[model samples]
Target: MNPDKTLAMVPADTLVVLDFETTGLSPNMGDRAIEIGAVKLERGQVIDRFSQLMNPGFRVSRFIEDYTGISNAMLAEAPSCAEVMSQFAQFIDGCNLVAHNASFDKRFLDAELDYIGSGYSGEFVCSLLVARRLYPEAPSHKLGELVAYKNLTHDGVFHRALADSEMTAQLWLAMLADTQKPQLSFAQIHKLSKTPKAKVPLYLSTL
Candidate 1:
């Protein structure tokens, strides 16, 4: 779906907070997503979730396994990336997406979707970029660090898809409140994230 046609129907707060635990850094270099996790948020509440481990048809590097706690044993019985993403495509239907470092997720999402001849209609907002504008003084904008800085609830899990997506969801909500700009449209926030930090206040004020 074209973002223009759907943006009007989709509210910024009604979105899927998504995360992908992958085999390595670049999908272009043949990396693949080992797991996909997401939470559907409607009006500030988590209404649904999607989680799955996808076998990439190869063993994950020891560093990747250690970093994400997703081992070869875990991927051995999982479905293929195409199968999992087909289901995920439905899960995120007609909803905008959010992620901590959205560029990374977007790359994998596009590449995986390309393999299935599918794609997302909704645009994505980067919580990391939004947080940079909203919490410039925070110790760091990394998901875990921002969660700690903002006092968002968590189970002390990181790198795993579901845990990270949940933290990102909480952080997104917090930033919404911090904006103090009620009922702002999704496009406004999207633009704000891309705006320079020093100009964020001014950009939002004009919106």
Candidate 2:
């Protein structure tokens, strides 16, 4: 996979929204990322895309195969996790990242990168956490629910990495649209996502 060299070339200003479909919930229990997806955003627009499925060296559960539509047969034809992550490490290097339910993705990212002796330098912002503060009136903050709540474009697909990342990118851009700012620094975006739901209005006033 040819990574976008510009991502590392302009590290400080780039935002990459990412998502991963894994074998299970916890990396500590040996769950591995089967697929990774991401879209690079520039000035609130998607500028580049990435998606890859990796072989985890073992078969996933029947349930996971059904849920993600990734099977042992498919994984056998894909590159190994270490091989795919090496490219992914370059793909995301030196760029701030956003993910829905980021804690889960971060676990796998950190773990896989560790195995490959590679890692990213950028910080992470959780779209899930940010949605709670930005759309407090929404019935749910899940990627799928928020996609529906905010009328984000979706192809009726979930549990797949690329589609979820695309939808999350829409959800993220919608939140930025709420800011009404032409550009926000990485620090500002990080701060906004971390702001309390009640004080979000006051904080945006400062922005």
Candidate 3:
């Protein structure tokens, strides 16, 4: 659970796959997350869900509103970011986290959690990075693209937190299923993902 330690394999039972819909690209620029959605998966099945819209203490631009379908009016009625993150911290307790393009989510997650004086112990896995290694032949690695390439079901929506998180969860599972190495530990798979793609087969053969 050390933050500095990368996980070795996909969690076998419980983990959380999450997504955030934000006002802009960088939390460092003061853009805040407008909505957060996550699915708790246990043994490849969704066991619980958490979704919330948070007021960012500022109005979002029309471009953001349009892109995310989350208007300023909708955020006006939502709880403050602190309140939502406080509960989110609880929701993710003792669970590893997975996110597509996890660096982006990790930045926002750490920022929001730091602001609330809270934190989680679980390490985060980047499904994006994993997919790049696992599916090098795929034309595109975007969440939606991977979903279709893997033939995962979706509700035909993107950019929203919950829907995107659901797609990410499916993509994560599909990638794991494709690994063909059920005996590999989570740490071993994590190590395999970080290995150069050309060397993956060599590493796996040794495993």
Candidate 4:
């Protein structure tokens, strides 16, 4: 199937909003995901959750520990990366995925899943990219900024996987609500996300 048709097959509520706290940037540079969090939503309501901390087989730097509050000592007793990712892969199976800056999460996800001999088939939606197109006047498109910009409720915490994922989910639903087109399919929204900001209205009008 074409990409749009594949995305259209997924129901809005079935999107898996996810986040990863990693050892560092660029999974290709040997950075590994130290924690994974995801929420399954249906019709803008959260239906399920998955959260886990993984032992990356190396000590996380003090900076990372301070940033994420996930210490190496804490991860010492956690499951191995392979173990947690195996379960995560199953949890997100056959579901569209969403992340704030999806490229970051997508890189780690693909790398980690590749390490586990697994992969997801569903398309990924970048809430950040979509927000940029949908709300050009907003001061910033950062997840937290968008949260505040849209007056979306959040726990006031950032960086940890689950909290960020939940916030991203809310931001995503808010973006969809702002679109004012409830009838638009996921594929349609996905297409709009890739359009230049100036052309979004024109594309939506065509829809």
Give the candidate number with the greatest TM-score. 1
In Å, residue 44's CA in model 3 sits off its true spot by 1.3
Q: After superposing candidate 3, which stretches have Cα over 4 Å from the reference? A: 1-13
lDDT of 2 by residue, 1-207 (tens): 223343333322358999999999998999999999999887676788999999998999999999999889999999999998999888887688889999999999999999988888778888898889888899988889999999877899899999999998888888877777646666676777888778888988886
Return the TM-score for each candidate structure: 0.96, 0.92, 0.93, 0.95
Residue lDDT tens for model 3, 47-108:
99999999999999999999999999999999999999999999998778889999999999
| Model 4 lDDT per residue over 1-207, tens place | 675467676655558999999999998889999999999998778899999999999998899999999998899999999999999999988788889899999999999999989998788889999999999999999998999999988888899999999999988888888887777677777777799999998887886
Q: By TM-score, is 1 or 2 better?
A: 1
lDDT of 3 at 168: 95
Question: How many residue pairs clash in each candidate at the backbone level?
Answer: 0, 0, 5, 3
Candidate 4 off by > 4 Å: 1-7
Query: Residue 78, candidate 3: how far off, in angstroms?
Result: 0.4
**TM match of model 3 to true structure:** 0.93
Task: Summing lDDT over every window of 10 consecutive residues in candidate 3, give the lowest-scoring window.
Answer: 4-13
lDDT of 4 at 179: 81
Query: Residues 1-207, candidate 1, lDDT per residue (tens digit)?
Result: 655666745567888999999988899999999999999999889999999999999999999989999999989999999999999999998888899899999999999999999987888899999999998999888899999999888999999999899889889988998888768777888888899889988887886
What's the CA RMSD for each of the models? 1.5, 4.3, 2.2, 1.6
By lDDT rank, best first, the candidates go 1, 4, 3, 2
Which candidate do you rate higher for TM-score, 3 or 4?
4
